[model samples]
Target: MEIAEILDFTVPLSSITLERVVLAILVAIIGWIVVKVLTSTFTTALSRASNLPGLVVEFLARFFSVLLYVILALIVLAALGVDISSMVLGLSAVIGLILGFGLQDSINNLAAGVWLAAFRPIDKDEFVEVKGISGKVVSVGILATELLKPDNTYITIPNSLVWGNPVINSSRMETRRVEVKVGVAYDSDLDTAIRVATDLAAAHEKVLPSPKPAVVVTELGDSSVVLALRAWTKTSDVGGVQGDLNRGILRAFREAGIEIPFPQLDVHLTGAE
Candidate 1:
């Protein structure tokens, strides 16, 4: 009779244990399925928006989904009367500490990059002068931005530096003014030089006539009078026009017999004197 009673009691307990085990397994499987479904739905929705790059959106979706699944797994384990909160809490603390110590610089730089990319102090494909280097921007990546220099060299500057410093964008304006100083000999005709310079500027294909070209005698130097010739050209043509103007002005001066005088130092030997 005693043995029979013990066997009956043990059998009910065994049945209860089996039931809990099955229930927990079913819950885990359901959780996995739900995670897969949720991630697929998220990706589809994000892709339909299409505002951002597809690869970037997909990466974010998958990352968040994995994180959510981790949390879900912990919750299911806790529901089964598992005291894993302490373990989870400890793990979170350790991860937080490691990130705080190891990735602080990266986080700061990343945040600055995001700010720059969003606000656009400088944009991709624009000409910007930063860190004393001027170039056309090629790529704006997370950590760095690449530029193609005027001389055809490639430059990569960190976003941290770009965001931290001032940037000068030349391409922002439709036109840019160029100022050139052409000096003539003190004895040469000042009015003629001014007229030649203005006419030379007018002849250039890139120079704009209005706000009409301006020429002024800025200063009288030791050997010559300096004429400041100001003209406007499309921002894209600055380099070629500048070179062409210098050559044209020189050629015109030579043909017109307008002497561009070099500085002459009148040195005398005092002791010999």
Candidate 2:
């Protein structure tokens, strides 16, 4: 049996000459290059000319690339003397069935992607927490959203899950509040402790002056007086400022002779039964 007979091609085996094979190879190469150039140009044009969100622009570029490649494939098949009309119809039917059943989750993800792109809840480079995962948004694609975690790991979440869950955007605000809780001995002077904490926060360069760093007595515990130090700083400086405050407060408390209390247990025993 000939090659054509195995694949049920309408074209006869004799027609599958070396020249046709070379032509097919040449067409594929050229088509691939053309597709690359077209997609690149289309992406650049959309980015420059339109106000669409970056994710939406990416989605459009991918869609256009897929469409062009499909067309290129059909042209290549035609060059091979294959009947394309029936093949296209058959492919359409198969695709329809796949979309209807096998790709339901994919369809939902795509829809969620569209919603995400349109609403602009999260954008590239923004720090966010969604579904208990915290990371910086890398790219939002048609099916999934990519995130770059703080520890240099990458995570990909399906758009459906991302859309269904609440998103916490930490980078949306210009500044963030940093709170550090400290406990002092019950016998320590509360006024002096508060003053030391307030001074420590105010001395930090990152801490905002307008809000004014404050130390408030939060709780009277079993072994200590709990005080909370609150300060505001630029969002990007939150971690650094918080660390500095913690270290500074510890050192300052020691120097000021204020005691940081720890939990203790007191027991009484009867001498006689």
Candidate 3:
């Protein structure tokens, strides 16, 4: 009778309850392992995706990891006979309210970042002009974009503004046009000035030959004739080539006895006398 009592005490819980508990434990373990494997795979794949940025890939990976963990918890709860409907509904409602009110700007920025990542309006090390700001793109992020200016200054612009405004990417192509303006005295030979400027542009090693550099009389100023020397060069060499052209033109003009004029005012003293 004592042995029977011991068995009865040990078997107080129903078989079904014991099975549910065991099942819940097993499922939880399995779900955890699966979540880890899947999240790793997902993160690796997202990182490889060409259109996605590093920040976005990382954000998505973390988000999905959390989501998978939540799902695993819900599954474990269901196996243990816990009602999750009301919990899910309540949690969703709270999240929705918080996101709706407090995270509007964040959501907008994230969306804009996604758009930029997908479309790729600007890229790293590329020169860009956007919203009156000019710089080289250093990095792109979910919240903002970083730019490095010519003077080594850094500018951070919100992704929303970057996506919303017009973006001019100067380094998007292999070649870019560089224009150098040379002004000469009105008495200088117009044809000779144009010839010398065009020759310098055509002779530059960085300048492309196919496009063929040209010189044009662009403007007639009060003190000088503004001649524009236009040439196409590799995007990476545009600045250096421009400087070279300006210096070469100045030297050539001096050798040729062409005078570059600056704006000046001559005063007459006849009224004072």
Between candidates 1 and 2, which one is better according to lDDT? 2
lDDT of 1 at 51: 70
lDDT of each: 0.79, 0.90, 0.85
Q: What is the per-residue lDDT of model 2 for residues 201-264, given as tens digits with 9 covering 90 to 100?
A: 9999899997999999999888999999999999999999999999999999999999997898
Ranking of models by lDDT = 2, 3, 1
TM-scores of the models, in the order given: 0.64, 0.84, 0.71
- The candidate scoring highest on TM-score is 2
Q: What 10-residue stretch in candidate 2 is worst by lDDT? A: 4-13
lDDT of 1 by residue, 176-250 (tens): 988888888988988888888899999888899887788899998888888888899999898888888888889
Q: Ten residues in a row with the worst lDDT in model 1?
A: 7-16
Clashing pairs for model 1 are none
Model 2 clash pairs?
A: none
Clashes of 3: 0
lDDT tens readout by residue for model 3, 1-273: 564454334224543365567778999999999999999999898877656766556656766887899899999988877779988998899989999889888788879877886778887778998888899988777678889888999999998999999999998899999999988999999999889888888889999997999999889888899999999999999889989998999999999999998897777777654
